[model samples]
Target: MHVATADQHTADWLMRFGLVRSEEHLNHYRRQGFAWMVARMFPNAGLEELCAFTDLNTLLFLLDDYLDHQESSASPENRDKKVKAMIDGFIRVLRQPKYGEQSGNPVFVALAELWQRMKKMSSRSWQRDFIQSIVAIFTAAIWQHENVKAGKWPLLADYMEQRQYLGAANIATDTIAVVDKIRLPRKMYEHPLLQELTALCRNTVCWANDLFSLSKEIAHGDYHNLVVLLSHEENISMEEAIVRACEIHDDQVKQFMRLCRYLPNEGPVMKMELHRYVEGLKNIMRANIDWSDYETSRYQYEYEEHVRTHKVREHYLMEAAV
Candidate 1:
């Protein structure tokens, strides 16, 4: 959300395009344009709905500022070219004949495609933010679908958000099969054909976990104690622990696949797959000393001490205020 002084050339172009009538209008246009792009790309969901579903109101606000900065700072010619490219891509998707047939599902498919295109146009930080945001959206969709299927609408308001509910339901009902078939803890992760797929999934999950951890930290103004306990016992940095987790996930998948090739393809493949993966996971757990009782207990104690100190500080502050 940093801004640079506008160069004369860029300022002239903005004047010509009438993009910035004044500094006050910059944020307004940026939000409007971004909202337009989102709506045009994902016609099924409004700005508020998308923000709610992804829980990304903060990020969207940041992105609005970012776009305004880019518009003000970047060269006029470059800005025009980039805008044209975005418009052209949008038009191409919209004007395509037999869109529904080509995409199978127009709403999600088109938005996913447009997201990838826009991601390329954004800065590196923005690209990462976009990926994280999409992952959040996808996760929310999955959660909603499961809630509906369970027939226990925990909150009636969740069900009222039709696009998110339906979109999540569709992904869960359709895409879950493909994901489930991949068989975690199976040897599939090690297989040449499936290695890339497994790696992609592990990376995606890790990214999601990182974001989840960040949110937890921000909410509590403190790091999660469980993670601290794990890190201390593992004798590794948090980043290293995350990497190891990803590695372990990939390894478990590979081992599972190796086990699968041995099993007879007679009865339930999923049942057999789980059995093999669980056996491999047991082996992995045994190999990691951090998973042992003594070290884990020590770390847990340390984490509790850390949390207790924070609680004591808060108690003293409240007493002083009173």
Candidate 2:
């Protein structure tokens, strides 16, 4: 997480303004590097704008953490019902698209505030797209909860499809447009190339996440991950599953590079817009690894150390061959 002088000035103000009641909660959220990532994504943003961007990510991360895993004493059935209600609350915001903070939940208040800024900054169509992308995340998170309850591992394709939304890549990139003032015309936005670009970034970032978070998820016995899903589908050990996951990341990245070469060469302004969008995608890819590697405590250095160990990989491959 690269912290600019501008970003450094804004960090304390953003934290104080956006944090909920708990001191511990605020500390945890800051530790996740949400503000740092926002500073990178919207490098040109002034203090207020950067704070707003960071607030959305902070709320989203906290919401995800609160909802995804089992932390409460509620029964499985009750937990599912609770998850449904939380997801439905966000879905209602999309369907109705309200302003003014009436909800008691600070998360909803934060989202409402974010939505207000978004509506002011971007087109209605973009807003719709952003909301829909966010809704996809909520829905997929419900799927995660349901999967945990049912004790069923989805196939690799299905898992990837869901985790793409979980990565929130679309929301992240589109928000970049608003914060950075990248005025990509609808034609460019709708182009197959751009869609491919977005999807590839989404896939790669999420799968990199799957790699970085593998040990954490494994320790929790969570199968809502690319590596674990592949392992199940291929009957491979964790190491081999990791090797396969790396292949997925490599393939997507190569496709992204290939597609970058073919991005339409047009007017100077349009080309620059396309270039900015591509750079935003790259920021996402790099930020995920940077945050995972050093910025966040959720993933352990020991996990990465294990990934680098040839013995584990070789042992798994040898066993699989036999």
Candidate 3:
């Protein structure tokens, strides 16, 4: 299925950018089956769009992992410098893709190529939206780093507000139009209803992830999770925090569903595109939960051994066939 297609493609893509250096690294990256999630989130995507989405998703996950590692291990001053460098390099590539082609950093070079590819597939407006989301991601990283440096957990409200951007859900959702080949007018896309729906979608995805990753984050003493933040801020038990976080996530899901009922009946084309976009958001929420439950080993330890074994067998089989 989608995993089979994206495995080779993503491995090659990551290796080309020097992001992955070994069979073990490729196995670890592929074990998450991000392409499977992307395929689920954008069910309407054709082959090309699916591949592009897979690469984009993989790149985002890589960046998040690298930064998260830096958050824990690197000194505050060192991490800040590294993060700033990344933000600057990425901004440069965003402005001019060719600028990073000659750079030594694989991430910069990779992003330059990926940005160029994305530009060819999206409208100018869509490109702008995607870039804004990316900048939000960089901003969120700085926000999180500052909180960590200060050794304080943000209040629940503040964490929720910024957590959506940290999750990159906006970038994922923004691609619906590209996948569907429907360019929404800026006015329609920015309508209050749609904007609210987008917020709900982002919150739902990010909070659900917090729920799934609670144990791991707690073990790592990472305070960037909603559940952890709520527990610490409210002086509540972990169980109480979990229950409250679930309540918040369920509320957002319900709100998203309720608002979809009132989608504007613009022109036929606009209406249809809006519905398609809404469906993609629904798919994203659904896929996030489903993937966390069934596919991702990051949250599910039982699945890790299963995934590792399966990947090893698949690798050997492919080698044997060759």
Clashes of each: 9, 0, 0
lDDT of candidate model 2 versus the reference: 0.70
lDDT of 2 by residue, 1-322 (tens): 3354433443453454464446575556566777777776566666666766676676677677767654345887777787787777776765554622676654555566666765776788877788778788877877777677777777777887788887676677777677677888788888999989988888887877878778777777777888888888899987788878877777777677777878888789999998888877777766666667667776663444655343222222222221
TM-score, one value per model: 0.21, 0.85, 0.90
**Residue 110's C-alpha lDDT in candidate 3?**
88
Highest TM-score, which number?
Answer: 3
Candidate 1 residue-wise lDDT, 256-280, digit = tens: 3354345333358755654443333
Least accurate stretch of 10 residues (summed lDDT) in model 3? 311-320
lDDT of 2 at 27: 59
Candidate numbers sorted by TM-score from highest down: 3, 2, 1
Q: TM-score of the candidate numbered 1?
A: 0.21
lDDT of each: 0.34, 0.70, 0.78
Q: Where does candidate 2 stray beyond 4 Å?
A: 1-21, 70-72, 94-100, 304-322
Model 1, which residues run further than 4 Å from truth?
1-192, 195-212, 215-322
Candidate 3: clashing pairs of residues = none
Q: How far out, in Å, is residue 19 in model 2?
A: 6.0
RMSD of each: 19.3, 6.1, 7.9
**Where is model 1 poorest over a 10-residue stretch in terms of lDDT?**
1-10
